[model samples]
Target: MIVHIIKKEIHFRIIKKLCVCFQLLLIVSCQTDDDNPTLPVEDSINGFWFSEELGYILEFTEGNDVVYNINTAGCSIVDDDFELEDFVPSLVSANDLILTTDLNESDFEFTRLSNQNPTCLPDQIADTDDPKVNFDHFWNIFNDYYAFFETRNVDWSQYESLRDQVTTDNFYDILEELVLLLEDGHVSIFDEENGIQIDSGFPKLLETFNMNLSGDFIIENGDDLGDLFGQKATTIVTEYLGGDFEIDERDNILWGLINDTVGYVNVLTMAGYGSDFSNELSTLNDLLDTIMNDISASGVSKLIIDIRFNGGGHDTAALDIVSRFMDQERFLYTKKFRLGNTFTEKRAVSVGPKGDFQFTGDIVLLTSPASISAADLFALCMKDLPYVTIVGENTAGAFSNVLSHTLPNGAEIGLSNEVYEDPQGVIFEAVGIGPDNQENRVPFLSTLDFEEGIDSGINRALELFSN
Candidate 1:
């Protein structure tokens, strides 16, 4: 009963060495005279700029070349070289350089370091396939990059103590225990050959929902859904709506009008929209275009977005759906990342309507504890809209983007490194976002008798629309 959301591709120029390398030469030397005012000045960036927080040193040369040195313990120091394209320099200054790129419209500041050699110490883990080394490397990544230590109340030191007890044969189990302490649903470990080997805290909630129902039951009678619960739930919802409905099988959206006024759309999973992130986003936008156009043409006065069983997906896909309902650009939330051991400054994230078919009518967002990750973010963003009301249970609390890193053993580890907060600066990492109307408890699809009445959540939404 594993539900997977495709991790969003992180486009931070600082994190992507290849993009940074190409952009660095263009950015450092291509400053126009109008931009800088001083022409043909000597390069002030020629020297080592050390980031004590990241334990890395950047060396810029007069030749417009850059070298990056990563200081990791037990592993040989890693260096990356980038050659700058030919360009005339307009100005040079001793002030800290702020690198800006279109990859993310954010400024990365780097200061000059006076120390010829910084005191940054490398991790004691070697860059090898050894189980102990792999384990230590994995631990170090979280220690250095994971942002929600204090917020999640995770004591990473306790896990370090257990390292000595782990053997090659039992290391995977030990690692799972170690990560589960963080309680982050985004954290997982997968081998290229064996698929997912560890999912620390994600399966606990699924277990609570009794996710072991058979597939035949889910498809035939659409019942007994354990983990394959969403399809049956969706079927029940469509039947309750009772209109000429259409299910976009490829996009997994079921849309129709309820009582000739309320437009209903039930989105199952946020993943599988396309093969890749870009294609997926395009496909999602296209689907939204069709849905919004139909709703507009049908003259619906209200809309219902059901994400009760959404297991999350790329954050961009969530934003894509949200954009159709927004009329103006507004700040939705802020994202923060870990630098060294401390969290960095929060960056604002906002979205606005992109297409002509923006829905201005009242919106009812249906959610459940199963609505997670990107789904949680969708709820957070929509809740701020004046016309939107959230119903059903609290959403799955995880909201950070899952970042994947490959170990020397060819196994990949994914973890949440960013922290997202609502407009009021409230963090909902462990505790999910509560609905405006909680009277509607999420009905279990396995035990539901739809003939009796409509889903409590849907009824509440209808009641709100009537009022």
Candidate 2:
């Protein structure tokens, strides 16, 4: 007799909002009874299943409940116990059980364990509230899942010696020091109760150039650029570009025609486009449509996309912006997760033209050490396009989807777990994308110096168009 499995319904809305990763298991309750219930021929699902990728364990109980534990360290474990009801499981093989979850349309194949219980589950790190335990937990998470230890040149094992020295008073400071060692703009530690959060490393990198490329600096100095360029430039009001979307004129974006032939758009940040990711993408698309439409209609022969100080936001936003310049679908990049000691297969990420308008003119993308995360990703995608030339400094090379995890001590930690590569299979995590032409390169923030008022990167771009 064939046994059909029924799954419990779970809403995707709640799942999407969850801070936790979706490595869930769906189990069916064992049924026995007055009316007689049918069961699968094999009851091999009752055992321990471990996921080294996520550092979690699942204990399938005889009563049909699963004990979920997030094991960051050998001693520490975060327990999240839940009961699975109204679901059926099928035996795909002697040791493989196929668990299906409803509504979310997700399924996982669990291999039955020969051992009933694992030895690692016993030591639950009793006092997770202890500062030492929390510190150890934080360090262990990175030791296990962080993919860039060698790339960042971090000696993670040495942190074990500091565990005993960390106290409640110095926990935050020590943790910040440890996190900063990664030198990743995407790595951060937040303890709201303790009023501690690690600042992005991108800004510190900007200081090396003796300039400030932040949005505030740009707005403060943008109006004065016309005086610097003299007859070569004109500062047009942002409203003249014609977009219905509301953006902070001071920071979000700045647009105008240069020399009556080149169109310039400086995108400050990928965030603040909207409240959520979807809305942010929609708002960005609308903003780009308006800005690109204006530039295309003006018959500009060249375009410059300035992201020198952009810190980044959603990757979807990056793809959306790049799509506006593409006339056809283009392969952008690929992403892969680390499974055990090795990485999983690469998944291709592509972008195609969006909306009715497209920019086909020669494009120059400006970069700096401050151009980070999604901003760096934007440079990566645009680098593949024939018309786009990258100028300015190398980007802030933190390019991965940030995964946020909450420790038992209530401190939040974010790190990059996935690896992103270009179509050529080249990874640009620590080393950012290089400029095609390195002429007249100015420090990112030095553009604010209207007295000198000269941007080597911009000048190089202007020269390219002039030739």
Give one digit per residue, the lDDT tens place, for model 1 in 352-384.
888878997998888876677778888988988
For residue 465, what is the lDDT in candidate 2?
Answer: 83
Candidate 2, pairs of clashing residues: 28-87, 211-445, 212-445, 440-456
**Global fold similarity of model 2 (TM-score):** 0.70
TM-score of every candidate relative to the true structure: 0.72, 0.70
* Alpha-carbon deviation at 392 in model 1, angstroms: 1.6
Which candidate number would show the highest TM-score if scored against the true structure? 1
RMSD, one per candidate, in order? 8.5, 10.3
Q: Which stretches of candidate 2 lie over 4 Å from their true place?
A: 1-69, 74-127, 200-203, 211-251, 447-450
Task: Specify the poorest-scoring 10-residue window by lDDT in model 1.
Answer: 16-25
